[model samples]
Target chain A: MITIAVDAMGGDHAPVPEVSGAVQAASTQDVNILLVGKEQVLQAELKKFDGWKKLPIRIVNATEVVTMEDNPAKALRTKRDSSMRVAARLVRDGEAQGWISAGNTGAVMAISKTVLGMIPGVDRPALAQAFPTIKGKPAVLVDVGANVDSSAQMLAQFAVMGEIYSRLVFHTESPSVGILSIGEEDHKGNELTKSAASLMKALPLNFVGNVEGRDLYTGLTDVIVCDGFIGNVALKVSEGLVDVIKHMLKESLESTIASKIGYVLSRQAFKDFRKRMDYSEYGGAPLLGVKGVVIICHGRSNDNAIRNAIRVATESATEHVNDRIEIEIQRWQASSTNDPEV
Target chain B: MITIAVDAMGGDHAPVPEVSGAVQAASTQDVNILLVGKEQVLQAELKKFDGWKKLPIRIVNATEVVTMEDNPAKALRTKRDSSMRVAARLVRDGEAQGWISAGNTGAVMAISKTVLGMIPGVDRPALAQAFPTIKGKPAVLVDVGANVDSSAQMLAQFAVMGEIYSRLVFHTESPSVGILSIGEEDHKGNELTKSAASLMKALPLNFVGNVEGRDLYTGLTDVIVCDGFIGNVALKVSEGLVDVIKHMLKESLESTIASKIGYVLSRQAFKDFRKRMDYSEYGGAPLLGVKGVVIICHGRSNDNAIRNAIRVATESATEHVNDRIEIEIQRWQASSTNDPEV
Candidate 1:
């Protein structure tokens, strides 16, 4: 049975959404949840459920909770008994298959690396968030908010991992990979992107040349790998743009009755767009290159988001992706090292 | 007189808009236009103009043109007689107070640095773009598509330049500066942003820690600094979002009578929003931290954009922003170097 650990004290709607989402996940599958947090608080929340105790849901009490303001390193160093830390410790000790946290992002990353460690041969773990394309297929954007200042080699490594993850999850045999750049031209971008593009060109994959930010919505590439800084900026900027447009649409629609009817007729498509952009439904971002399946949920996750995170974790654990990533990276490194162009 | 060199053979619309824009700019009392391109073509376009060429418009002959597809460095080297190249050279040779090109951006940047050289103590120049906020104020986004993979020091330098530019150009004193990051929390973001935030904290400027992408529209910060890769991505994504929404709104309004009425009444507000977000009005991005003033306009610019670019260049040159930037950066560097925290 797939085992999942949940940080019950995390998120904006902590305990309530966490317990409900976990219980909901447990009821649907033969999965055991080690709910790490205060037993009194969780037990109080749990009693509100309708016989959820029969669904293999158990509470593992911990005295401490890591506040959002807590320094990630210091919290991991000192809060040896906190729910977030202990939950990660369980995954590290092999008691749990995957760990999920909707706590502070820094805390989640810090605890995971300190406890679970990086996958062998993986330089640093990357955060990969999946965005649904116009085609309804997911495009994996790696290092969205992880490692910055990555070398060209690391970028190539991200491409391999992104390809594997996209293929396994989205079931695409030949996923097109792209590097983000200012211009579509070969010699358009700065040194890092140019060098990374060259490296991607030499790779044994369906490597498309540079794609601009406009290509993200066009669904031109299956996987987009960028440095965490750029990736995060792109992700956040895209999200903000969506919000702005949505607001504009609302303001425009409410101004007229005919437009409102038009909006109603097109409601299905608008809802489809909203669902396509929804991160909660896709679950948490996976910390790629981690030894175990470490999913980083949003700090403001609700019941549905947490459940989705658990579902993603279970699927990834079953696939044994870490094993495949290890072999792929090694094979790629060896193959590319012997080649002159690389 | 503020003498500005305009590359007439540059943009997609070439001399048509370039000549018209120069004629328009010449209408301003303090402006003189040195129209740089093939004399015959420029004069032909100038003749079609509605009576203003006799003012201070002069034609400079340039035999060649730089296409967007050509390699920037290679084209700059080979096309020494190109209108774009001569315009840059004129700025370097101090024959013009400033240079404006709505042509090949890559060639412009490469040629500008090669011809004019960098201002002393400035490592790399930044392409800062001015954006209008919903609050009716403007925010200067630095490194818009320049200096990709920029370091914390480079970003810090951008913050300084952006501050001075915003103050002198937009007339905002002690404008709030924000480093774009994934999370608004102080501890979030990649190494570059985190380091830059720390460096910004130590500067004399009013640094407003971290900002999310949505904060841009809300007018939460006056200046935003990020690497060119991210900046460019944000620019394109935001532009695409706006376009998509505008198309949807127009489609919705065309379908019904009530919607038509609503559209008519809300037309002013919608126009205001459109005008605020319209990037073309800003003319072009200034090549900041360069010794001489240079503005890189959009490759697809028309006459109005070219004219606006010339006006922008004239204002920047008249303000002596390049010289002011040197003193500001040097003083900031000198003062912050010996801080006790350092």
Candidate 2:
């Protein structure tokens, strides 16, 4: 069975959701989970669930917790035995195949990188987020809030990583990658995207030129690459707009008696729609280009999100995604060195 | 009477929506409309609308038309007598108080800036888009695809211009301005936003520091400023997400007979919701920092959008928004030079 480490002292309401999610995953999936946190708090939470003792879940003691307010560098240096750090250590020490956290994102990234190290030939790791497209399949958007002020070469690397993730995880035959920009034309982006476009075009992958923001949901490309700043803004803006739309729909459906009855009758259809758009269904975003499998969930993720994240981590680990990434990175570096066009 | 010029040969479906919208605006509002386009085409379209001859609308002949595929620079130099250029010339020659176009965005910006000139002390003009906020008030987002690769000083100028636009056009008192970034912390942005933040802080405007993409619709700040590339992507992404949500809602409502019935019952409420979210209601985004009032509409705009653009252009002209923008820009420039913090 694949072993996964869960940071139980992370997240907004830690220990409870983390333990509950581990129990659910261990009970259903063929996996073992180590809940890293204060042993007593995790044990107390586990007692509330029936048959959790029979599940392949265990408590791993952690002496400290990293608060949300703590800076990433400070948390990495100071909180040596924090739950997040302990989780990363478990993966590094071969105690677990993968690690999952729902904590301060920067702290989780820093600790995971410091402990697990970087895959050879990779300059920086990226966060690859899966977005549900209009064509009923998920697409990967890479470098979503991982590093800022990235260079053209970094963006080109992200495109390759995102393409591989789409092919392996999403099961695309051959993923087509596009760089996000203001327009779909070749000459239409800021300086970063413009230079990145040239670099990406010369790569061995299927590089479809530039794409605009409207194409994000169009499913025209299997993978989209952008800098962390633009990618993060796009992600958050989509979330905000979706919330406002849902709010508007709710207000309209409850405004009158007829509409209220209609809403009740059509509740199942709405439920299905909600499930399709729910972020928790996709689990967590994977930190690519890292030496080990590390999945990072939102700070406010719930039990369902955590359980799904574990499932994703198990699949990623079992597939040996990191090994494949290292192979691809080495091949890319060789091609760039030999290709006269580059 | 306040006279407004309409580019009758612009938009995806030229002359039809323009002439119809001009007739509606002239009949309803206390304004005169100049339809600038091919004389014969304008006459043919005007003939389809009954009683248009009795309205305060006149057709101005233009010998050329700028197609969508034409480059902005090329169109400016070659198509000097095009409908868009003729309309801008009308505004510049004191025959019209303002001008409205639903043509190519780049072409419109190029022609308007060349014809009307720039407000003193303003380096580059910006496009300020008004968005409906959760608090039921509109917030202005500036530099929406005007200039890319902007400097820190230019961003500071955008903040000042956006502040003036919000206060004058939206009628917000002492508007609060914020810089768009990845995080809300003062130190959470890229190099561009970081340097821009310091410059904005030294200005005399009510600077609220940094805001994230989620704050775009929260009504927390009256104005949000960003570089054109980021601003354009944010605007387009919001639009794309809204379209997807609406599509999902429609698909769900049609999945079952019960939902179909519910949709019928809730049709009025849904209509109200649609009206509130409709882009036509808010009209075109005003191009601020220009010497004259200019409103640029979407290429796919309908009759209602054109009519509303006319209304907005009239209001902007009546308020002397350009003069106000000039005064505030001069004040910001003076303060930036004298402030020690800068």
Candidate 3:
């Protein structure tokens, strides 16, 4: 059985949603889950749920917890027995195929990278997230917040990784990759993106050239690669805008009696729309390029989000995503050195 | 009377919407309008409207037109008599207090910069556009597509200019300025933004430190400054997302018969929502730091957008925004030299 470890002491609600999600995943999916946290706290939380003892759920005691405010590098050094670290260790020790966390992002990234190590040719691991597009398809955006101030070579690597992930996960035969830029033209981006574009063109991949911010939802490309700085801003800005748009729509819908009644009739449609745009449905972002399958969910993730994250983790492990990434990176590196044009 | 020059040959539907908008602005506002383009063609377009001779409108002949695809620097040097350049010349000769263009953005910027020059001590001019927030108030974003690879010092200057513009245009007292970054912490951004933050804190303006992408719509700050590259990407991305959301919402609302009826009932509310989020309502973005008032509109601008652009240009000239920016820059420079803390 494919076993996954959950950092139960992460997230804002901690232990409650984490434990519930783990139980939900265990009961539904064909995966055993190890809940890593303080045993006494987790045991108390687990007792609240029915059939706690029968489900494929086990608790692993972790002495320390990494708070959201803690510095990632420092926390990783000092809090060796933290829930996040312990969960990563489970994966490293072959006890679990993958690990899921909703902890401090930097800490999760640092701990996962340090414990899992890097895939053979990969210098830095990127965090890849899927965004729903208007075409009802999803595009994978890489380097969301993992590596800021990325070089052209790093961005090129991200494009390759993103392309492979899209092909594997989305089932696209030839995933077209685009570099996130200010404009679609070759002369539009900064020095890094410009250089990255040249390198991408030389690779044996379907590089669709530069795509702007609006393309994030337009389904213009299968995979979009950008520095973590740009990707994070784009993602966060979109999130914020989505919230504002929803709030405005709610206000408009309920402003009048007629519209409120209309809203009632269209409530199902609205639910469908919300589900389409909802990030939780997609679960957590994969910490791509890591040696092991490490999924990082939102810090404010609820039970549903956590459950979905585990599903992603299981699928990633089943697909052997890391192995494919290593193979592709080696292939690309070999081609760049062999091709005279490159 | 304050006179504003309109590039009649600019924009996608040039001389049509441009002519109509000029007529509209002439009919409503207390400003003389100079429609600069090929006089015969503009005259024919103007003849379609009633009472064109009675309105405070006049035509200025220009022989050449700058196509959207033309190289900006090359066009500025070669197309001496282009409509955009002529309008800028009109502003330079004091025939017009301000100029507005929806043509090639680079060409417009180059011509305006060359003709009007820069304010003393201002190294670069930023394009500032107002994004309507959920709070009903708008936040101004500077360097939307100008100065793509900006230095730390340029970003600091943008903050000062943004602050003054917010105070002058938005009628805010001591407007809060924030540097746009991936994270809000002091150590969160890349090298450019990190250094920019330090410089911004030294200025006398109400620097709110660093703001994330979500803060753009949250009304967390009145003015947000960033390098042109990031600003352009953010703005365009928001525009793209807005389009996608509208498309998705429409699809959802029209998916079923009951939802279609609900949409009919909520049509008025939807109309109001669109107007609130409409870019035309905000008019054009000011090319800040130029010696004369220069407003740049969207290439796809309609008659309504053109009319509003003229309104913004007139207001900018009336408020003497350039004068204030010059004075503020000089003051900041003097203060930095005297105070060791700065």
- lDDT for model 1: 0.82
lDDT of each: 0.82, 0.89, 0.91
Docking class of 2: medium
Question: In candidate 3, which residue pairs get closer than 3 Å at backbone N, Cα or C atoms, i.e. clash?
Answer: none
- lDDT for predicted candidate 3 compared with the true structure: 0.91
Candidate 1 reaches a DockQ of 0.29
Candidate 3 regions exceeding 4 Å error are A338-342, B339-342
DockQ list for all candidates: 0.29, 0.76, 0.81
DockQ ranking of the models? 3, 2, 1
Model 2 Cα lDDT, one tens digit per residue, A159-196: 87888788877788889999989998887899999999
TM-scores for all candidates: the values are 0.86, 0.98, 0.98
Write one digit per residue (lDDT tens) for candidate 3, span B80-121: 999999999999999999999999998999998899999998
- List chain A TM-scores, every candidate, in order: 0.94, 0.97, 0.97
Which tens-of-lDDT digit does each residue in A1-342 have in candidate 3?
A: 899999999998998889999999999999999999999999999999998889999999999999999999999899999999999999999999999999899999999999999998888999999888987888899989999889898988898788877887667789889999887889989988899999999888899999998788888798999999888888888899989998888888888988888898898889988988888888889999889999999999999999999998998888888899999899888877897866
Per residue, candidate 2 scores C-alpha lDDT tens digits across B206-294 of 99999899888888899999989989999988888777777877898899999999889888888878877777777888888888989
Ranking under lDDT, best-scoring first? 3, 2, 1
